[model samples]
Target: MHILRELWTKEIEEPDVKSSYEYVLNLRERLDDTLKIAREKLEKARGRQKHYYDRMAKRRKISVGEKVLVLLPTDSNKLLMHWKGPFEIVTTVGINGYRINMGGKEKTFHANLLKGYIARDQDTSQATTDERPPTSSCAMPAASVTVVEDLEGEHFNDSDCEALPELGGWGSEETVNDLKYGDELTLDQRRQLEERAIMYSSIFSDRPGTVST
Candidate 1:
């Protein structure tokens, strides 16, 4: 009577019933060997994965009191995010964690979410100087000037210089006549014509009147 299919169906000479204990002991030893092989293979696989990860992973060490930008979500949308802060690192929490001081509040964050911030040095040589001629008290006060209103109800005050929309070179019929170029003109000649059009742009002003001496 075969109680177990795998042990009973084996094509071998019948084992001596007297030595059944020895056969069971041998099977136990074989099972131990199989388990050992499986453990070794698992360990080797883990080691290989660890080696590849270590090669690509950068080891960043941020010290206490150092300024770092923290990765955070934007106010408009949580999914849309950007690096927001140059918060100071207050202390290290644990192995790969850091406590950052955001304003007066302290928050713990992972090392991966933080980046060091480098400040740029100011250039003293490029400092600007005021070169405008001093205005005399006899000059007319700017507030006394009259304000003009366009047809669209938009007001143009004496103080505010509103920027008009660029009409390119085709703004007026006169500009179009001056910028006329033949189709056969070379690229350099066309570029020169464009430069001339830009230089004469002041004449294509949309202002109400011309300046009088």
Candidate 2:
């Protein structure tokens, strides 16, 4: 039975031995044509998939001495991963790989497993400066004065400093006014608070190398 052709219809005719041979040869040619078409479609599909993947993938050109975070597995669990290090790129290993200074040791990493590290302090300072009200300039720069006074204190300890008190409500006119503290506190109390803050100002300081042991 010629299953491929006969399955569609009941009407059938048995071929002569010579005719059967020709039919088998014809089927083989048809199969080769079908296989070629199948292979072409597969190649086109692979090309389309590659094009979409390239479009979605992130491309970064990391330079030497630039800081980047690396994706790595945790010590406790190999399956669990996290971004670690703001490690400096010592050199480029290859087209998409970087050699990082993981402390004294160097390790090569693929670019896909690395991302640029941006220091938040600079951005935070800029954002705060921009968002500050114009009237704040007119107000007594008590914090700036205090910071300077704190720097002079030789006994100031970062470990002694406490966490900053949270403002009850943020971004309100009252919150801004309350931050001045001058109008709210008595003269003696304000002086004491300033002395306390100055004694432990190392924690509050944004300056590098300010924290001493």
Candidate 3:
């Protein structure tokens, strides 16, 4: 009983212990308030950032049936790339979104990732003939195939071969000459064959000379 009384008296001699515990509790509350304030400030900064970003964003207006190019995210080693699509707008999904036809398949995209496509004006006038690429002289006009019915050696079984006709143009002329007595081709047939041969030779030679009919 005497020792317990002496401990109680020693605690009474130290008056600051209770006040020190209360001070630690108060400091903890202040720290919590500081953290809350910091979090609020961070949120405000994020809001401001979003506001600036939206302010700088461009508004795009597009309509159905319009042609547009789409953007795609890709990892590539190439220095330059062509944008993904020249897709057609099928419908509007919302104010800034649309449904597009991607190579026959339907897909959706946002306006921010799409660009309007402008087609070059095509001249419908006769002047366009000048712009027209020169007709490739290398390509021979369609010709009629004169399939000989007589027994022959090394004959063309398929008339699908593109060749100039005896007329110096494109067409096929099939004729069967009565050569039952001999393997002799008629004079008219010979003339026709010669004309076709000359026509094809002229085409291959790339000669600028014209053939007389």
Candidate 4:
């Protein structure tokens, strides 16, 4: 089943609308069949799943400012996001619906809607060993942030770089000095370089706003 899902999802890339719908339908049917089998097996098996799920109490109320995913209505597909923005609940619009404020706009939806609305944020601490592995991509570094970072950067001394790494043993000291001195910038070249630096830095002496001035 996983191999089939991987092939349908990762291997196939994005199938056309028709294919995706058909594929999702097939997946749900398969999942339903698998669950049915599991349930029947549980009934006959010596061991049983815990009654924790049965003991859980249903929450009767939801309120304002809490973040929640809108459970969508399968009967209607008029809404853009069947599951969308973590909308803040404006107020309880009764058992069938809720008045929600999403992205600065107030909208309402039925409480009996589609999927992803949790009564409260699920406890991350309740995560089991079989839950997803730590995703490396975009995961933040596990380090305390340094608040007083130097903006100008750690000082890099020019004197250390001034001593060339090698003396270029192929040439005498005088010969190398002559070669470097011969390549030194001319006055015009130096002035042009200084102008370029100023231009790149977007710095110039104060002048009247008018170009002619």
Best by TM-score: 2
Give me the runs in candidate 1 sitting further than 4 Å from their true place: 1-36, 124-213
Per-candidate TM vs. native? 0.45, 0.46, 0.43, 0.24
Q: What is the C-alpha lDDT of each candidate?
A: 0.73, 0.73, 0.69, 0.57
Q: How well is each residue in 126-195 modelled by candidate 4, as lDDT tens digits? A: 5654464433222223323323333363443444334323332223223111222224889888677666
Could you tell me which residue pairs clash in candidate 1? none
Off-target runs (Cα >4 Å) in candidate 3 are 1-24, 73-81, 124-213
lDDT of 1 by residue, 1-213 (tens): 342444556634456752574577678889999999999999999999999999999888999989999899999999987997789999998789999989899999998898999865445333432333334333232423443455574444444443333233323344434556889999999998888778777665544457769
Indicate the residue-level lDDT of 172 in model 2: 25
Go through the candidates in order and give the C-alpha RMSD of each one to the true structure. Answer: 14.9, 19.0, 21.3, 26.1
- Looking at model 4, residue 82 earns an lDDT score of 57
Give lDDT: candidate 1, residue 34: 99
User: 124 in model 3: Cα distance from truth in Å?
Assistant: 7.8
Error of 1 at 81 (Å): 2.6
| lDDT, model 2 | 0.73
Q: Tens-digit lDDT track for model 3 on 1-213?
A: 443454546653555765665566678889999999999999999999999999988678898999998887555745554577678999999799899998889998888889999876666555787765433334334433454344444333334234423434423332233112234988887777666765655444422457689
Across residues 151-185, which tens digit of lDDT does each residue of candidate 2 receive? 34344344434432323422322322123456889
Task: Please identify model 4 stretches exceeding 4 Å from their true place.
Answer: 1-60, 72-82, 114-213
